[model samples]
Target: METHTELVEGEIDLKYSLAERVKTLTPSSTLAITAKAKELKASGIDVIGLGAGEPDYNTPENILKAAAESMEAGFTKYTPAGGLPELKNAIIAKLERDQKLTYKPSEIMVGVGAKHVLYTLFQVILNPSDEVIIPIPYWVSYPEQVKLAGGTPVFIEGTKEQEYKVTAEQIRSAITEKTRALIINSPSNPTGMIYSEEELKQIADVCKEADIWVISDEIYEKLVYNNAKHVSIAQLSDDAKERTLIINGVSKSHSMTGWRIGYIAGDETIVKAMTDLASHSTSNPVTTSQYAAIEAYNGPQDAVEEMRRAFESRLKEIYPKVAAIPGFNVLRPQGAFYLLPEVREAAEKTGYTSVDDFAQALLEEANVAVIPGSGFGSPDTIRLSYATSLDLIEKAVKRIDEFVKTKWQD
Candidate 1:
């Protein structure tokens, strides 16, 4: 027997390497901070994690019961790659009921999660160097997914002066011949700012004129607060509907993050392509999850409203406290469950050079974890999710308040 080995026993071979596509992907700062907080908690520390985007609530009992029934009824086998027709009908009913819009079952594509659905969409739509316009302070995954599909992410700054929302003019200005799509996230992650109806119409007009696709991420649609409403760009016009693809799921609204069910509603061709890609990539979403989602959409929605009210209450109670933190200039968010404060002044006043450093110090010293805005393309700010209990949210804000006070240099 010949022992043929060109490498040392403990040495990694140079021939095996990760693909270049994955090389540019950045780790999610929110998950990284959440994991560190968990580590601290595991080691007997009381770490308050405001970094996670998921609701602290459990999946509603009705949904859970439905999932159990599905398994009991022998629904553990593989389902169609697109989803059960029943689930698709429920989603169709939801759109018609909520937005006065109609979609055929052929236009709905279900996947593992909203995140996965978006990844699939990008894969099917983007070609090499096609540009997608992403507004600033975006969900961390948007740009990365575009890049993964060989698309370039072109950003338009949604400065705090504009309530962290890009206008139609901004979108129009950023469009180039390479522009293939634009992503709009109302009740947006990190900021929680909902765009007005007029804003949507103007943006729809721009997309219509430019003849580009609009990817409206309405995952947070059900969580609007203080009388604010969510208007889908697709609802603006038939032309707008034709150009828009809506991505949503039960994760936030139903607290079903772990259930891993999300879907897309759009042109039949696009849905078909995504479905074919999913058949090769995921085969199908979890069988029980699809059943749970059918119940999520078709079942009574009292739990959804109750959770929304709870989040609203928490937001109202915590917003003032978070805003009162010295050097933290925060706008009162109209929707969703996060408070994004421009903290560059806070960082500078506390002798830190960057918000990222300030956030790190907060996790270590104050035992409070927050996602730095650098990950969201807003380097001067930080994102604090209020999806946790009111007590924990209050305590976390208090700790942050004291940390800034203690560290203040001027």
Candidate 2:
């Protein structure tokens, strides 16, 4: 047996060490850059942040009132681990009304947020060494969550010319016997691109033929612009619905990022497994937040439309200005409040070797914070969220434009 002193020293060493599963995980680059921007602002610096992937608007008044009413009625105790029955019914109704898809309460599992819902999903469905197909330039959490679940993430690149959306052929080529699931995030983060219905149907056929699960992340379903429509892969056919897990929340749609409400709609067996796991883990989603989400689903949708229009207007104003910058190639985004601009040539012209170095220089020199695309599996581009005011967007883009011109030309 080890001596007491030796055991105490071992414990001390282990205190600073993390689990093997999380040791290789990368921190979220978007959150990191946003934190740095906030830190700089706290120090009295003029930092223009375009990094956070959240709406600047507050949660709608009706939702807030619902939460307050629920609390006043003393409905604050823990509900079912999956979620409250009322909220599940609301989710089912919302899906049926919006997507023409029907789901029972047993087919839905609600968690802390969409992130938590996805994490729980991977935990229940993934076995060790199983592979999950993910597209490049994906959300920062997808790969990390797969790794945390003891699964490998296989990535296929989606080139800029394709609007950063991958094709079914690429997915077909990447599949193998070990493949367990494929993630499809329409209105994708870091890219703001949506896959069309035809494209989704093609992808769904491949998934069905290969016996793989389709994880459809539609968190930004309500944010499409330019008359673009958002279609769920689950809506393709009954077989597609049977094989797809629809993950969505009110965070982006209702401007309720802090409300901690998201749910997964999928097969009853898988949802039951996730609920059982949550029973031992989170116990339940926040009680008050669940009520707020119910109101968000059933209340007037004018606030949602208002926020969508505001984002669309901002996109129109900023897209041209950013695209006009020298050596920058920007794709006009069809959905979501983000702009991913390829800045490789601009970085080179400004004497930087890579976009990562260029991003750091711009933040330090111009006090403008944007996420380097290296973390999103694209090192040649950068992501800017236009969730702020139009004035801020203009000022930040102008500063970026001036920074490039002054360094390269003058």
Candidate 3:
């Protein structure tokens, strides 16, 4: 929201209009809140930030070494637009090892990150007026990416009663002739609810019957806890395999967020078109990061499990405390490093007209930052990422609890 200065007496002034696609685009709320917390911290404020979406751990040592070796070995040059063959093969091996899904190199396209890979997928497959089904309380980017592709995002509410998951019947009812695809994010961000294999089976059947694509975003596949299993919709059957596209990356798995490596696996024609688009857009993903991703998949997986264990431990320790806050109701997360609690009652009791305003008050007065659920299509709730230290999380929760206590009127 920056403003431009007026032209001087003799200077020419140019006015340009932004594209329709970007004119109404909403910036990512999670990132915006995190940035604000960092800004406060930079100004010497004692901010306890609960808005981070990335792991606090450094990238695994082996992956870092691999990236360094790739640079030293002159593998820093541009790779193929799709990605390096070796990296794609490693990704294929990962699918086979984890999900028992077979894929060839031609079917895989690596992009800057899972976010960018999704954008590329939508761009290639969507046409004007097409519709994509997005479940409620989705990751903040899904609807925006759909709209950017000239596609309409048709939302289906996933009620808290259903553990914040959309049922197959809902998907069926939401479909129409304009429906081109459906996005499924298991171990969902904000909610941390993992769809069961049976749920995925039912959903896969609906997608096959409807003859629409399923964009299965399994970026948090490796981060499940509580003995819960992660299942890919593609594994449901041959038809599901043909219709589902799996998107994932090393960022969440290997603490490689800064590495900027992610990929999509599906039909070769779709992947090829995305690759062609990327060639004209990004040229290629960072060459060293691609090489590092190869090692991330091929190297020891101990660090990945270690980080998952840490997040699980924090969730167990913090869920009760967060739920204990007056007027806040939170479901225990099955996976990922987030706790989303419905705070509408809390906001009302504390005199805030909206959850977003309550969240801003928490940042300005309570010195903690949390992403309001309005950004994730669940305005009654707020998302608190537990990716920070347990101590910081505890302190932030305490601040929020005390803030509500002080503001309570009834």
What are the lDDT figures for the candidates, one per model?
A: 0.94, 0.94, 0.93
Clashes of 3: 0
What does the lDDT read for residue 134 in candidate 3?
Answer: 97
Candidates' TM-scores? Answer: 0.96, 0.96, 0.96
**Clash numbers, per candidate:** 0, 0, 0
Model 3, runs deviating above 4 Å: 1-15, 30-35
Off by over 4 Å in 1: 1-14
Q: List the residue pairs that clash in candidate 1.
A: none
- Order of models, best lDDT first: 2, 1, 3
For lDDT, candidate 1 versus 3, the one ahead is 1
Give me the overall lDDT of model 1: 0.94
lDDT, residue 55, candidate 1: 89
Instruction: Tell me which residue pairs clash in candidate 3.
Output: none
Candidate 2: RMSD to truth: 2.6
